[model samples]
Target: MSKKLSFTVKLLGVAGGVFLAAFLSLLAAWFYVQNWLKTPLQISDAGYVYELKQGQSLGYLANDMGVAGVLNHPRLLRLYARLNDANKVHAGEYFFPQGTTPESLLQKLIKGDVILYQVTFVEGWTVKQALAALEKMDSIEHLLAGKSSADQLALLALPVKDLEGWIFPDTYSFSRNTSDVEIVQNAYRKMQTLLETEWEKRAPNLPYKNTYEALIMASIVERETGHHSERDQIAGVFVRRLQQGMKLQTDPTVIYGMGDNYKGRITRKNLEEPTAYNTYVIPGLPPTPISLPSAASIKAALNPAPGRALYFVAKGDGTSEFSDTLDAHNQAVRRYQLNRRSDYRAAPPSAVGN
Candidate 1:
């Protein structure tokens, strides 16, 4: 072969070799990136919580995680995210478990799977108790803090001054930085909706002049007993009392009226001292709800059981004994209240579920 031709062939071979090496390098990089994307994060057993602020991009998350040493090669993850059209990430708190991979993390953000904090308003809980519970949730932004109940009521824009039974007793889940007012509003809306719906299906001859009156009665029933089986019976007793123009004489109302003064037990004088919430002194239902009522209690109030029961006494075993006459109630009170057992509980240990 000619020298010039041989030189040209060598040059071509060198170029081809360079091109092959480049191809192999690119292929290796591609595989490395794929592996990196699927690799589990280097978070501790306790895991890591990341709060993505509003309007933050996926690239920000990648760089942030890389800086935190949760994963190496955040650039590759960012590239993967960009290529997959997953640059949009929702803002919220996210928990990164030990075995979470880049792909899964990205998916979680894309799907807006944020950490949810729950606040529960228990049945028979007073508004004060509910607000206290709400304030304890660190994730919620407290707008009601350092404010009077009246001020908080105004802030919430509620029609009534007293929240009382206005909020539904249930577990409410919210994302991070959720405002306290928002949560209370949600609970209020839920309660209003539920009450309206239940009010529509109320049993005939119900003595409630309006839904609000029924709500007060429901709150009374909620505080009277926690037994799901006895809710209707308890409601029936109170309903009959109202219909017969008799006094409710429930202790919970008196305790509510006592407010911060109540140590643990009620006294005869406490019952006699008339307060707006004391059903013992009030001829009919209390001026407002004394506690948050459960949906079951509301249902019971609207649809009282068919019975002649006019009174009930707590059996001290998370249940109540109902009677058609005052004498039976008095007997039950003596048996259960006078000689109460050491393990006596007016309500069950768990009084949440139906």
Candidate 2:
């Protein structure tokens, strides 16, 4: 009877040990699953959305993130972000949910969702005109106010004395709350990138002193022709004149010097007037670019077509004829300008001339 009692006690001890081990294993598995659920997962949903304003506090962000299902606990999210030193969140529209883990929310906040605002700078716009257009943008105007033109130039990281030629003509997308400095910097950076690539493969014997000079010439080319097919030919004529040490004698340069208050027509006296940007007076490139040039015009300036053409004149139609000799140019001008007075009738009433 004593042996049987001892055996029963040992059996009960073994059973208790086995149950305890099983309970421990189950607890470990449950802990692992909890951790796995909290881990950041790249999930998307149509209902998730959030907005982060400039200077929004961490508490406010936490509340919004919680409502949007981006965080399980607002307090936890704030604590985690603060503990990890993740407080520098830029202003923009964000889309997320409370189901999003703390790690994922932190990552999204760090990588700001910059809302792209499309700004189109048309070809042939002078710096003043460009600035006027920019001023119409409330955000840009707000940033530019109280800032001098010199300050603006500095913001763009331009080596030049002004930002006249640096703002590249293109359709750019910027954040709605983007500062004027950032907008200008983006344009200048793009211009620099384009110039670097084009300058490396520029045509042989081009007379430009540097990429800026090429840009200046390209602005003239852009203003000269609205026809896409005529850019190369017009570029060729200007390039030839430059190589021959002749004046550019472009009418657009004269118009540009007149400023925004310029009257309807460019008179003969306007061409002779001396100004820093007057191509008619200056033998080489103007002191600065007259207008914003398109990418096509820049390409034309870099790789002008091979030709002996020195002169060109608008043929009343949407195109111009090129000439190798002054006599040919004179004849073409007489035919296009003298006899084509009716063709150059006043611009249509509905048409707004730039």
Candidate 3:
């Protein structure tokens, strides 16, 4: 009986010893992971800004962070992330402050706390011009010009066949990972919102078939005049010509058709050329808009000033003369364009009135 009791006691002691050893080992590992191996608070050599491309894994991110001096051990960070179930990470440009810890960094990346780049699309830029500007940004170029215009069109929701005049000019902040298509789409949405509001209060007897036509006229007016006060007057002249079934005879349309080679001058020969976008031959609005127009020009198109003025000649000064009669228009043109010895020599009136 004594021998059996002693054996039982020895077995209980061995089992308890094994359990204690296992518990101590686990506690030490937990302490090392949570307290000892954690990153210290210090500015990283990565200089607070880092760009992560698409398809980059967490392991790659840790390697970069380690090289940038943000992390002391890339492998350890990876292990910690794996244990925490942080397998998926987002890609973007991140602005990391000095002294970011591994845990905080992981949280930020998981939450998609990326840096935003501010981009402003000007009111008068065409779709091509907008794309050129976007290309200048290294982050968004790859996602553009993929398979077809159909794929590109899916990004922007504008009604036009292509993203020509839909992008509204405004300041926008985008993540570094923002796709090219998304940028175009954002601009198109903003333009749509603006047009919907303005279309409700359009002027009576306007020649435009709809808001789209009004937008086309507004783009023309934007290119025609730099003077804000003259916008409505210019819009009125175009409206009058359209009602009279007369050609727009605007020089901007011809220049637009010429594309990148426009040398700031539109010769008489250029007007005679047959192009699908040439307003001189097409008569009505062009197939698509030539340029983006400002809100003021859009308003002018929707609510043009009441007038019989069918012709306008830019005086040597910034202002232009509007005339109801052909003889009056001819006299204005002669005074502004023919006589170059006067104060208007800087902008010697070109013979724009016929």
Every candidate's lDDT: 0.82, 0.72, 0.75
TM-score per candidate: 0.85, 0.71, 0.71
- Which parts of model 1 have CA positions greater than 4 angstroms off? 1-26, 338-354
**By descending lDDT, how would the candidates be arranged?**
1, 3, 2
* lDDT preference between candidates 1 and 3, better one: 1
Q: Which ten residues in a row have the lowest lDDT in candidate 2?
A: 345-354
Candidate 1 structure, TM-score to reference: 0.85
Model 3 spans with C-alpha error above 4 angstroms: 1-40, 44-46, 52-68, 72-90, 99-111, 146-159, 338-354
lDDT of 2 by residue, 197-300 (tens): 88898988899888889998888888888478989888888888888888887777766777864575655465567887667677887788878887888999
Best prediction by lDDT? 1
Give per-residue lDDT, candidate 2, residue 102.
57
